[model samples]
Target chain A: MAYQFDFAPVLQHSDLLLTGAAFTLALTAVGAVLGIGLGIVGALCRAWKISPFDRLFGLYVEVIRNTPFLVQLFFIFFGLPSLGVKMTEWHAAVLAMVINLGAYSTEIIRAGIQATPRGQIEAASSLALTRLQTFRHVVLRPALTRVWPALVSQVIIVMLGSSVCSQIAAEELTFAANFIQSRNFRAFETYFVTTAMYFVMALLIRQLLMRLGQRFIVGRPR
Target chain B: MSLVKITGLHKHFGANHVLKGIDLEVAQGDVVALIGRSGSGKSTLLRTINGLETIDKGELVVDGAALHDGKGDLRALRQKVGMVFQQFNLFPHLTAGQNVMLAPTVVKSTSKREAEDIAKEMLLKVGLSDKFNSFPDQLSGGQQQRVAIARALAMKPKVLLCDEITSALDPELVNEVLAVVRQLASEGMTLIMVTHEMRFARDVGNKLIFMHQGRIHESGDPKTVFAAPQTPELAGFIGAVQEA
Candidate 1:
């Protein structure tokens, strides 16, 4: 007996797959924005050693980078309830994605910030720009422009990683894939489509981020 | 009237004692040149006047503000004193106009319209009126240094510091930058320069100070000093620079 390919069974569940994809994208949208924002603050602290937060964010990046994403999700979803902290599965999934991406983007952005030429800072200071002003006006955009590709890759990684949210019953794309496969007993077909969806999403997001970099970060002269 | 006064100035880089008990004075409208061998502390002394390098012991007064005590309003002092570097440190991410307009708009809160007008005027002065939108990397080193000069002048600084402003340019490119500095000097913009351009220093400087072993070994009118170096150190330095 040979494995027979069947499309009808998987096609019947298009509604579930679409909703699941929409959920995954929503989680990614929220995660990338907040995560990069958090990472910017973390990078500033780590790069400039901005007092108390430097040590705190340093510990955060180390811990999150060392641990597996699934464990972090479990800890947020399962372990936190034991300590009287309660959140929905959706909240836990989004929070885990944010923290994970935040740590990675922090390191990436800090590398960019640390690469800033020493003379640039001296020039800004000589022009009477204060430390904060220098960071905002002189140091930040170039740093972001340098690290944007890495940041975009990290975001895609987190989006794919969000598939693990299904284990916590978050009803994301992978959850729908699992639900469809279990009901119709069409494992191979369901997984094939799910994999394709993820591939397409990643490509689309990379294009979106590249356009964003050109428009806002690079701000290239016309 | 003296616009800058330094007395018993001292600076150290972890006991290197870069500048030792230096005393100097600059009057309004003076174009002073500092020339010396590398590691002789002439650059260190120039940096101290702008509060870029703090003094370990002594008094530095620029534009009526005391800077040595570490309590002076450094921003205010810097606003009144502009500096152009050998590297021409224009913000690479910004265009030439934005670079010139940055200080006036941000530090002084000049409106965008006013800042743009000032940038245009400064760029015109530097002969870069057409490069208002060019980024730093798009310009040659000489052009970048000229833009740096414009950026400094946009602040309307009472004094300008040039730290070997043309030293990083190619030999052929050096004169374009030097010409801008010469023009500024002729227009009575007080300038203190650390330079190796002997011809420039001789032609434009009203006073020339030669440093040796962390001290002003020779000081006088440029013509007098170059025509008859009072110290063997000055003679040797002039010889070495001229050979290069």
Candidate 2:
């Protein structure tokens, strides 16, 4: 017996799959914005050595980085309710994604900041700029320009990682695939269609981010 | 009063004492040159004056304000004291004119328009009016140093500290930067420079200090210092440079 590829069963639930795809994209969009915000804060904190705050943030990064994303999602969704704080599945998924992405972004951005030369810092100091002014005007811009490509790739990785949120029953693409497979008894066909949709989604996201990176980060006509 | 004074300055980095018991004085508008071999602490002393290097034990006064004590108003002292470095530390992301205008706009609270005008004037003084809009990398080493000079001058500092400003430039480019320094000195801008160019030090400096082993080995009129160095170390250093 040969493996038969049939689309009719999966095509019947296209609306459900489309809704799931939209939810996945929405989660990624929100998570990326929040994650990048956290990343910038974490990067600056680590770079600036903001005392106890930086130490605490360093611990947060280590914890998030060391553990699996699935465990992190379960902890936020299942574990937090025991502490009298409850969150919806979507909220927990987004939060977990933000935390995970934030840590990775921090490391990437920290490398960028460190790669800035000492000569540049000395030059800024010679201009009689205060430490804060030097960081804002001199150190930050060049560092960001240097690592923006890496940052974009990390963000796309974070987007793909959102599929892991299906474990928390977040109703994203993977969850929708699971639901359609059970309903139609067509696991292979359902997954095949969802996998193709995911490919398209990832490609669209990568293209969009590339355009954005060129517009804002590179800041040159292309 | 001397515009700048250093007495018994000592600085150590871990076990390495970079500057040991350095003493010097500069009257207003004096063009003083500090010449010495590498690792002789000439640059360290210059950096100490600008608070880039903290002194282990010393007193440095610039325009009657204490530099080493850490009690003197740093921003005020820095506002009156400008420095140009060997690397031509212009902000690479900014245009030449903006680089010149930064300190004035930020510290002096000069309006952007006024700051631009001042930057333009300084750029013209450095003979780089045409390159005002250019980036630092776009200019030659000589032109970049000129822009650095203009950036320093835009603050209208009473004293300008130069640390080996021409050391990184090509032989041909050296003269262009020295000419700008000489012009600034001629215009009565007080200049204290750490440099290796023997001829420029001999010709341009009103006073010369030759350092060896983190100490001022000799200090006098440039002609006297170059013609007849007082110490054996100075003699050996001059001899080595001459042979090189």
Best by lDDT: 1
lDDT (tens digit, per residue) of candidate 1 on A62-149: 9999999999999999999999999999999999999999999999999999999999999999999998899999999999998889
Q: List the residue pairs that clash in candidate 1.
A: none
Candidate 1 per-residue C-alpha lDDT over B10-84 given as tens digits, one digit per residue, 9 for 90 to 100: 888996988878899999999999999899999988887777887788887888878765457888889888999
TM-score of 1: 0.97
Chain B TM-score of candidate 2 stands at 0.96
Model 1 alpha-carbon miss at residue A81, Å? 2.6
Q: Candidate 2: global Cα-lDDT?
A: 0.85
Q: Over the stretch A104-131, how does candidate 2's per-residue lDDT look in tens digits?
A: 8888888877888887777667667887
Regions of model 2 farther than 4 Å from truth: A1-3, B68-72, B106-111
Which ten contiguous residues of candidate 1 chain B have the minimum total lDDT? Answer: B64-73
| TM-score of each model, paired residue for residue | 0.97, 0.92
Fnat measured on candidate 2: 0.44
